[model samples]
Target: MNRAPGDGLSAGEVARRLGVAVTTLRSWHRRYGLGPDQHEAHHHRRYTRQDLSRLEVMCRLTGEGMPAADAARAALTVHPLESVERPRTGSALSARAGGGNTIPVGGAGPEARGLARAAMRLDVATMSSVITRMIGARGVVHTWDHLLRPVLAGVGERHAAGGGLVEVEHLLSRTISETFAAVPRPAGAPTPRTLLASADEEQHTLPVEALAAALAERGHRSLMLGARVPPGALAAVVGRVGPTVVVLWSQAPATAAAGQLNGLRGTPLVVAAGPGWPRDGLPPSAARPASLGEALDLTLRWLPTAG
Candidate 1:
């Protein structure tokens, strides 16, 4: 698949254009057989235009959270000259018949259902576009609670049922994370007076990311110490920042050590969030906000206004 010298891109150039690390490209090459197809004696390998296109698909799909293997498989199927078109609304649903697999979005609306299908297909471009549009139209909280959460729950449910859409779950989570990160924070907003982090060993940080984005939407700011903050580190951050409000999140019971909350006793308003915490075991001084909406409300109320 080697092409003329001028028609190929070096690994670095491809990585730069694709917004991925060179190391990631190497890993994809090594693990998934998705490397430069052009090589010469005593010379470095170069990626053909087709190779670059395939890698772009790989990066987008994996960035959206598709498993590398699955993304690579999908990427390899594309012809070099073929344009990657956006998936049509409900197209994923229509394509699912006889596939013996589907993401159950429960009572979610068409958008959520469509998102679930897109996720199943590892359609990152479409997924991201859908998320961005939804956030713009419905606001972060509405999109999170209604569209994103339902699809995420369905992905989780399918995985729990042993149908195994781990790639879908990962891709959807990544897409949501990127969408939230893209939210525009207000200029001249006060320094972040709120600190947010996940409990130790709690890898689920989407809720907090959503909360941060939601805060940004309202012109509030927060320091999001994403996922798995050890108790000592958490305490050190609190001591250093002296934030007006500190929120700790945990996504599973195993990560919900009450001691983490207890360590933040001196923080003015310590809130326990997510479903991982035991109802009775939370630090007596900490408040538990039941949902993202409640958490956002509490954080806002406790956040000190900047001078």
Candidate 2:
């Protein structure tokens, strides 16, 4: 016998210590056979120390972004001390979490590792939930710089190396766009004085979107023209709306046409953002923002704070 009934812990107390709900405890029991092993005829079942240990493993793994089913399986099987993180043999999570299809999130925290695993499996709910939770906890800039960028770059590099994982890349991008676009905007915000768009024929737009979301978090508004606006079109928009500042993003050298900045020279502030811009060809009027924070700072200088 692991422990006498007198020494067993209650479900309510276990849940409180684990920072999860009692219902969650019940569900784990119903699903994964993780309920208290100690039972008596007259008294309700109570969890033993070993039970708590397994539940802790489950919670830790799930918190690190492992799916609930896999976490539960790992919880039931692994040695509490030495093998908790390693999922059981033939588990999908074991392969997906560390196998050949992994995304390289160099030196990032557990959250990034979890996010990468979820991304590789194309688990949209886990990916979205992890991203939204991180953004809510640390704000957009931190989440983007620390979490999203590494995974995105990893996926890109992997695809470039062998032209594989294109599906993973597209799914992750769409999920990011949907999540970033969901960042709440200020109510009754003034007309946007800042413009954001990708460079001509440049399809990559997530970095610019990050700047937009960061601005939104600070109660600022910007005209998000989205990806691949031709120079002439940007000029037309500038001529008509006349944004105080416009940010053009170029992710590769091929799209960083210096000519794109030429049309918007009349705009009061033209920010040539992203790595695509040529070192020597930017117009003297074009301001170069080195990071998302710098772009945000530059845009804020042109617009009043929104309520």
Candidate 3:
């Protein structure tokens, strides 16, 4: 709802106003071919006030579950703030489900609702406070599993469909990962039996980073090799670390079933945690945690002395 006087807004500022990231804005621009009027040298992006206003509306609509392309077209066609809302799929549909599979914390007072909003917006400061509350109440592992996962899953569904603000999700993921990873564990904590890393072609590593951070908080050391770690490198790390539990995240099930699964070898327990994980036909040695909390539970069971 906020706007500056001039018609120009920096790429970072636009992302901040829209509650996303500069990189995300760039991705949207590239993928959907939407943008501000001009760019500075080196291909930096800039938006006029009209452009910013339109993008704001577009992001809002998309966040509410409209596809980015449709939202952009609608934003261009109509006044963004008008009462008439365009019918689109994704966020709007999920929101209209009246709080379906999302966190059931409807009307948990203004603070909780505000926390949810801040999270949805990817406000770093507010998200920090929210995470602190979650950790205090549910412990790091449970908070990650129950609260963060659902919210992020919803966000991811939106992003994949070009409905969610990609930058916001990226910012939130980095913020949460860093915050949780920094929390100290007791001395002499147990080492996890398994390690997890993303396979080649999987660009989404934030989920696994959060999972690793939660595991670390519980006194189980898990190395996060980051996105697109080569399967061969992973196999080497597994050989050296000898982790009992190995976790993999795939945004697409078909990709994992075909190629990413090549990254999973030698580990007795393999857990694939993501929306793309198969509901059935998983190998007996492999399992799905549904959320970071469930993954931590398995980690704790394997390393009972942790925490």
lDDT of 3 by residue, 1-307 (tens): 3568275777778867876656667655544444665555786555777677676666555543444566666666654423223334454323211112122233243333334455666556766766676777667765665556656665666667655466767776777777776666456655556576776667777677777766666666776777777767877888888777788888776446634554565676777777776677666567777667677777667665753
Q: What's the TM for model 2?
A: 0.72
**Tens digits of lDDT, candidate 1, 1-307:** 2344366778877766664557767766665567776567798787777787788777565544454566676887783323333222232322212223467878877677657656766777878987898899999999999889988888888888886777778888998999999999767877788899999989999999999999999888789999999999999998888888998888899999898876787888998898989989666778888888999888888765433
Tens-digit lDDT track of model 2 for 65-179: 6766778778877734342233234443243222345778888777887777667656677778888999999999999989899889888888888888888898889989988
C-alpha RMSD by candidate, in order: 10.2, 10.9, 12.3
Candidate 3 error regions (>4 Å) = 1-112, 119-122, 157-164, 188-192, 258-265, 279-282
- Each candidate's lDDT (Cα)? 0.78, 0.80, 0.63
Count clashing pairs, candidate 1.
3
Using TM-score, give the best candidate's number: 2
Give me the candidate number with maximum lDDT: 2
Q: Against the correct fold, how does model 3 do in TM-score? A: 0.57
Candidate 3 lowest-lDDT run of ten? 95-104
